[model samples]
Target chain A: MSLPKVRVPYLLLFPGFAFLFTFFILPIVNLAQTSTQTPIAGGDTGEYEQTFAFSNYIQAFVDNKEQFARSFVFATFSTLLALLIAYPLAYAIAFKSGKFKNILLVLVVAPFFTSFLLRTIAWKQILGEEGFVVPGLRSLHIISQQTTLTSTSFAVVAGMTYNFLPFMTLPLYASLERIDPRTIEAAGDLYANGITAFRRVTMPLSLPGVVAGTLLTFIPAAGDYVNAAILGSPTSKMVGNVIESRYFKIVDYPTAAALSFTLMATILVLVTLYIRKVGTEELV
Target chain B: MATERSLSPEARSILNSQISRRGVLAGAGGLGAAGLLAACGGSSSSGGEDTKTVRWGNWPLYLDFDSDTKKYPTLEKFMTETGLTAKYFEDYNDNDEFFGKVQAQLKLGEDIGYDVVTPTDWMAARWIRLGYTQKFDAANVPNKVNILDSLASPSYDPKRESSLTWQGIMAGFGWNTQKNPKGIRTLDDLFAPQNKGKIVVLTEMRDTLGIILLAQGVDITKVTENQFMNAVDFMAKKISDGWIRGVKGNEYAQDLTSGDATAVIGWSGDMFILASENEGKFDFAIPESGGTISGDNLMIPSTASADGKKNGEALINYYYDPMVAAEVAAYVNYVCPVKGAQAAMEKIAPELVNSEYIFPSDKTSSRLHIFRSLTPDEETKWAEAFQKAQGN
Candidate 1:
């Protein structure tokens, strides 16, 4: 039998393809081209000439390796912490909350209603030396007077986890809410306790959400500069801050673009490996 | 809408499957495109008509506003006299940030959407050096004669061909009176063991490093790379030792008020405002080694048409009138660059007539030093060192 030809489907793809080509693909191509440029000789502050200086990538990596390492380290910690916090909260909202589920979900996302920068600044205040957190801890002799919380790695990580928690929770909640209660009940009847049932049944089923949530949290967290800027000290500065300063302050676009491409490539490779390890069958 | 709700399940499923993904993706794409458009927006119109509307970009709280009238009185008066509408924008938050925003357009000789912009001295010098600014018609600004003699000839524009001073501020050490009862008299005092983790420095490279260089007995006016590197090393040591709390911009004032910072390297005008609000809670002191003085300057970008330039000059000329200058000085609490504004303040706001910070005493003036303009190469090197020390 001959298949029916359809012109509508191909036409339907045009808008999406055009949009991505103009906004995404074009910019990435431009950024890739910019990554190889070099500063013009005796030029003004921001002047540059395209020289195909692939060495920019090496120079950027060498100069900012510590920042790059710190970025991934912080992102990994924050992602793990967010998962640990989000899973339980998502589970409760999915199974425990009766009519208040929608409200709980809104509560999970209420922090986003405020500006991200403003929220980060609020965190700075809360963790400041003179703020309630430090003084209270000092009063209880839990921390020394000079041991501040504001400009530290811990604060930066905590801020990232807090800011990105919703990204982890919403996905987990969607997958968890769709779970069949009968399967878990059957597992219970088949000589399984609550923990065993969850591990054997629910956890494996929620792999898609876990994978999706972790990727969402990790990618943006790795590129986050505001949290580190507001809460972290120079010692805790991340790669994102370096890129920002290079582009805006130093006006060194080539190094900034090179670092950006490196970051994107690193994330792409890591994500591919992660998906493969997680198994493609669960993603659908 | 009612008919659409009555669709069959199979048909609705097919429709939803096909349209939902594209709909969501299209929505997101539209949002992204809107943001990109907004980011690149500026005046695209060329000047042929009488550009009666002048756009002025300035820092926040730099002009007096009548609470009762809910309008900038001086600006209103200027507009009525010139028959021109002035659109004032308080978007000049930081000099470098503003420069980064407009530099691309300025380089291409395109309008940055502002007829007048107020950038700090170093940035203005850079603009003049790059030929990105238009010269003011001296004939259009007769009130320019009232400009302070000391400010009439900056090294960057000795003839005052391109820029005019808006406000000058002293960069010095300020401390909370309640927090530091003994007082912070010098850079050494700020770095003393007792003040550890309570000190905050400015993020502006010139203000922070210039003060440090001055403290080290190096003249900031013509600092050498060795002197700059030494200052950077000293700053890095303080940062690594946790002696300095953080590097901040305008937020240093908030840090001071909240007691997060006991002492800060801050602008004199900000210190005055903070002190006045807190009532003896804060005090500003110029270090014995002298403090760095810098000014925000008004200049027309090269993109401005001849008509726009004239209107900008008219606005500048109006503000340069000693009475109008005094009005701005009384509200802004910065050093007025117009020479006769001090005497004019005697009638306008008598209380501020002798305010030393706004109109520096001869002794105070003698102790203030200007950080000399750096060559492009030196600027890049110094900025890189500063950024590294800043942990970027």
Candidate 2:
């Protein structure tokens, strides 16, 4: 069963290539096909045929523009919040935590042990009207009696940030840990202050992590329906919820597929522009 | 998705003793992933691989489950007596969601991993109309005669050929008793100012819209398209005005338990379970005008193997036995479809024998109305309108 020397790389790449072809590429092709379909003239619900109805994309977009915008807005807010919180946390673990770095890293990833849904639901309870947080704020007159946390856009964004924090932290830690402290010393030798040395040296070096962390956090958050479904009111729903309801509830497969393709294309364009703007060739 | 932290210690224990279907809403993704894994792993069990095996896909908490043993006692008994290995899956969350999951496979004429499935009245109609279901063999289910006369003939399954009624569901007002001591008996009560931003409604279009239509003096059984759209418009206005918190399924119980929802358009059975779990903190009332009544039917899919169909019929017949039906009715607290299940309840859980939820009296039954079956065109169009109203 010996492979020819020139054929070895192909042999080694076989499983990965096969998996991607079957799970990813094929589904995308099928989705593209489905996106252009039209329902049968007199068929039952969910019956569709290949009619090349590209207007489905436009219809889906026009109908769900609010949700699409909401998805991106929520994703952007969560990504920025996650970066702001995770960068400091990851910095402490990478540099200041010293011998306790591994333990601190474990603590950072501890939430993954529980199901994502469970954690999100837990957040719902913690922010719910009966939960201590809302009642406490009300009693202190910090919040009005009518003010609640759960089922609000704020809760949805908070949940997204919490759920995706680890995605931001680990990559930032890897990039930050790779930075040499001497780079900072060299900058300081050039008469730079603590903030300046870090910003000019360490921060620039961690751009790859920022790029990777932001992408990781943003992509999943943008597609997330759970956090919004559990914690947000109907008004806070995102595109993912629309797609889900379209596919399952309405049985409008073409519209759902069109929405999905549009989402993917939009994400692709945004990511391309983002990478181009950030100019991070060494993204994690 | 309500966690233990959302409940009092007492409620948590009660919720633990019974498998609250709403609690497993979190497992929806996990279940889908498991199905994918099974397909990829090539360990998937084909239907009717053996006549001694039968698999049923049903709604969560619809059967009698024992928390300590982590099993359905009636199911275990059926398996023991029939010498069959019966697998039960609470794979159904919503009619559309579950049907969508299996529809592609059904269209391909492939085994959908279950011999029997319980779809609601409308969904059952859809399945039959689509010819996706198999008619039962009368000889195999002699106990079919035990079905209630009222449920014996549905528009979809006249003469009860293709489907058998599993449980009757009543959709009405469910509210936190403490929050609305006066009770919510009318549509106006459900939309009161005090309950603003705290009301949830069922995603079941029939129930939610049917209640709204009834309140507006439209007869559900003869509801016109204009009448339905009026109700839809009313709901959309409420949602846009931020009066309604959510349009949900069984998980509305989660909202009620967590105090996120003060009132709901919820099922009678779920309200009963929530009331017991929370020490009567919750209560259900059939609206002064009326409430919507429907049934989930157990039917074998057409793609099921002959032996699987036979096994499925046996399973259905077993459940129809009044004694067996009584046991499940006691736990599920839904309206039992078995004709003599109420009399059977006298011997088992006599307290529930008089319970209106499990066995509604004539007066209570008179207040329940079945939503008219929609034409296929109306089904799609109306569902689209309903989803639009929910802001989906």
Candidate 3:
């Protein structure tokens, strides 16, 4: 509808906009301001000096570059690997399989019904030094004696992938399922083999799902302090863990707020650039 | 609304200098784009005005309520004497998380509606630094003489005159009999090859590292920057080497129960939970090298209403009554700041009365040391070095 005709709908949207305005937008602005406000060092009637310095950003990046780089690398690698494992399983149900497709879909989304913390913790218990997986592996002689999975990067990544597999697979399945099977059959009719048919008709069309699923799996995993806090060691701590330490462990509100806003701004820039290069609309 | 309206244009503008409405609206917009956060909760619970309330934020499972009874004796007597009602809260899960939530109201520079707030040692220091807490007059708390001469005048509060301590306890060593029949006797026991993968320590920056710092024979309380660096370096090395089991909450007890971890740096109050669960299987002890002794104190917020502060200041003194302290001691199993409360508890519940964990003998007292404040640069370097050492 034209703007003149749709004034009522716009009016209807005011409540939601007002709610978001009061709760969301106000906090970020306040966060940026609070981050810069320096508490009085020496006296009463002394107010915090409002200085807009960018050192908080420097601390998040240059000062703590190692953890920042590790977080980015983890996000990228986990997303790519999730896409690889997810694509084949989704393809089987969408392209070749006839029966049990809906049943398989239910199974994919089922784990989410339980507590995410519980599931992540279950993985920790299973992967601990004397836990289910390590003991079972030892009994079968699949690994050497005395090797434990607890407090390792492998355990962290494995837990991440397992927790987020449904996110990756469901989107890929939806994208693959929406494709016309006859297009592949049409390629075969023109004398293309199975590989050629899939490469030409299916792969190009499914890129959107691959991108979406990768994002759905990866972005949340980047901010996952819980996984590191429970399943991994200090070596496995992420940027989220650092943010938490500043916010809670130390009462450096200015530094904590500075780190929070800096992380947020960095994520925005990275996402904006990615969208620009990859065509944001296609990510759907 | 009252204060804002009372402000003249100049005063309002001054308040707005820090954060204007536009700034708040902009932040709300950004948060909307993020997602809805849970609403800010008020101070604990209150049954309402018919009862004068004291809003408390204490650790979970610390307060005692009988299975069939929710009786709190000190609270009852306080109500009887003062004709004021009691509304105790167990809302504080961790000290830092509570600070994060309360910071907003503090910034708004208004009544947080809490009559009393409690936090641990260094945290009390942070409140004093931030000016978020109120100052008290020593004259009001004449009953302060009831506090042990030894417990008075902590490093955090030089006169022991400002903040009222919630409970003071030693953050020492605890062991499981299931793993070490002979016990992990000293700080060196933590780094032993045999104990490599089977140890659990606390995540509190001061307690964990300070214990290790003391074990190295460095005085954690009186340390230079270089000495402090050595302590962090040592801790970071052990953490990165995977010699430590996990840093966590009170679940160190759970880790011991499941045999995932054998011994840990633990609080004495938590020993009550573990001893109940595993019976004589576990015990808490101070190592020979001496671990950090810490305490929690109740602080008055700067914004406490004048009327409330007047009464609350007196109420703080009132709790120091020997009978009141003894009843509180039975309910809360930490060090009785009140001098003679232990003997009173002995007359009440002889089992808990004799428990040495609640009242450490004088020998343990001589070795105990309270934590010292970190300089800003030192704090920065310490947090960074620790983080780097924990890196993959």
Candidate 4:
């Protein structure tokens, strides 16, 4: 005898779906609603009324273009730097390490064991004017007495690179490990040298990982405010810092929400275009 | 019905159980939604008369702690005498940050879980203006007579109904004596060539801008937007020219102690605390032009129940006693806001009774100016301008 079909999968998803609907989707809807609100006449510190104020986006953009540009620039630099540093390290672990591979991988990810804020704060001490690095550099005459490393753009970019390095390394290591030794050997047998074999065979095969690593590093670096807040000066403020101050210190939720939406939309458009250009057919 | 008839009895029963499970799941989901709605509509008061505990939120290091007992002496004494439990929290960090955390609940007239909180003058003004605070019951606090006349009627609460002065602090220049032996005497001294990139300024807009306005020959208490922006412009130039090392809040103390900054626009209380630790290595000076004097004030939030308010008032009254206030003042090292506390301090800690930072002399008091209260528009505009000047 045949039994009637039951929709168990849909039933299993109902609880989780309801949770996301209530928490995630509802907040997004509320944020979107708040983005179009304006302060009421003579309202108290944080009071606002819905006015369909679409110009808030334009106003936020105009007011904070410098911060937006700085964020993107910092993110781009950090992504490229992370890739440069991580690719070789990941490649070594994938191909060169014999018995110490596990330990090295653990070392690569060990920074995560500490809190992100604490690690960033440690960087502050290391890069401060009174810190050993600065004093040593000054004694060597590499930097002037008046110059500092703690509150500069370089400090901010270095912080972003350091914080996001593991994100780039893990993905590259995964892709690189999947590369067959036979392919490289075949290229070598076909008269290609070591560099040519890596360029043609290994590198091209690792494009998927490259795309994933860069996206992972770049997206978070763009939205990071902590490093900038702790290690960088006001001149190095990023869009995330502006958004943070707007929300917490200024209590201007409408402008902050509008700015957040604009940032999200911009990042989405850029990422989509990037993925499309990179072509993800060979990602697996 | 046709499909069910084709199924075997066992399979049909299994299917029936599955349907029942789905029904139970839907019922649970509906129940959860209703529970959430009920929670949202629940009473917002912190506690009723049955609660013998009062929650007090304050800034870090603002209380007198007895290291030997590992407890706040005055607070422990109060609890013992009154048979009340005091849940003390040092969670009141930055004014704006704490306000942001509680503003929504406060706006809804809901408890933020604190019966008493100490906010600075400007923030207390905003709380009073928004009706977010409850008036003190004078009958509950008979020690209100000990409140110093100077702090009795602040412009924010002219009748002293909603807030009582917690502690007064001065915003002035703090210098590392080893690094800058000459020390800072004026705001212009901060801009000197040798001091470039070695000077840290406060992130508090009022303190920083007030001093700059004072240096520019403008009164901080009657500042116009034009005057304020002019002062801001001066700061903007200093920051862009690299004359200023960084803009910081409470962390400026770390910079000074670590020698990352030789001079800083810092708080008097912090400098006093730091100097005691480092001996003659550091010194604080009221800038020759003047310095900003601000105070943290205690108030009961609107969401506090009548019982909680009574308990909070009793706590305030306990602390307002001259002997208890002196103990707190001697430990905290801030300007005492209770009359007779200085005299009471001589018996408790004679060494601290003569400290200028704790009890300013008339000449020093004359050099301290209070930042004017801002209108709503001015607050927004000035904050935006200051944030812009700070390059955020």
Model number with the top TM-score = 2
Residue-by-residue lDDT tens digits, candidate 2, A180-207 = 9888889989999999988899899999
Model 2 CA deviation exceeding 4 Å by range: B1-44
| Tens digit of per-residue lDDT, candidate 4, span B112-198 | 888899999999999999999999888998888887777777889998898988999888888887766776778766666666777
Worst 10-residue lDDT window for candidate 4 chain B reads B3-12
Q: Please give the RMSD to the true structure for each candidate, in Å.
A: 13.7, 4.9, 12.4, 16.7
Give each model a TM-score: 0.91, 0.93, 0.82, 0.91
| lDDT score, candidate 2, position A249 | 84
Residue-level lDDT for A48 in candidate 2: 89
Indicate the worst ten consecutive residues by lDDT in candidate 2 chain A.
Answer: A275-284
Writing each residue's lDDT as its tens digit, candidate 3 over B1-392 gives 22211111222122222222113234334333222211232522321322355444555544433332234445557768877655455566687788777776776776665666788887777677677877777787888777776767776677765687767777777777666666555877656766677677777767877787788788877877787678777766677677776777776766676557777888776664455444456766666677677777877777666655655676787778766676666655677777777787767655555455556656657677776776555555565565455552
Higher-scoring candidate on DockQ, 1 or 3: 1
| Candidate 4 segments exceeding 4 Å error | A1-5, B1-50
| Predicted structure with the largest lDDT when compared to the true one | 2
Where is model 1 more than 4 Å wrong at Cα? A1-11, B1-50
The A-chain TM-scores of all the candidates are 0.95, 0.97, 0.89, 0.96
Selected candidate, larger lDDT, 1 vs 3? 1
lDDT for B1 (candidate 4) = 28
Task: Report the lDDT tens digits of candidate 2 across residue range B200-302.
Answer: 9998999999999999999999999999999999999999998998998888998899898999999988887787767678888888889999999999999
TM-score of the candidate numbered 4?
Answer: 0.91
- Model 1: per-residue Cα lDDT over A203-254, one tens digit each: 9988888988999899999999999988888789999999988887777889
DockQ per candidate, 2 decimals:
0.43, 0.63, 0.31, 0.40
Model 3, residue B199: C-alpha shift (Å): 3.4
Tens-digit per-residue lDDT, A69-134, candidate 3 = 666666667777788888999999897778888888888889989999989878867776557788
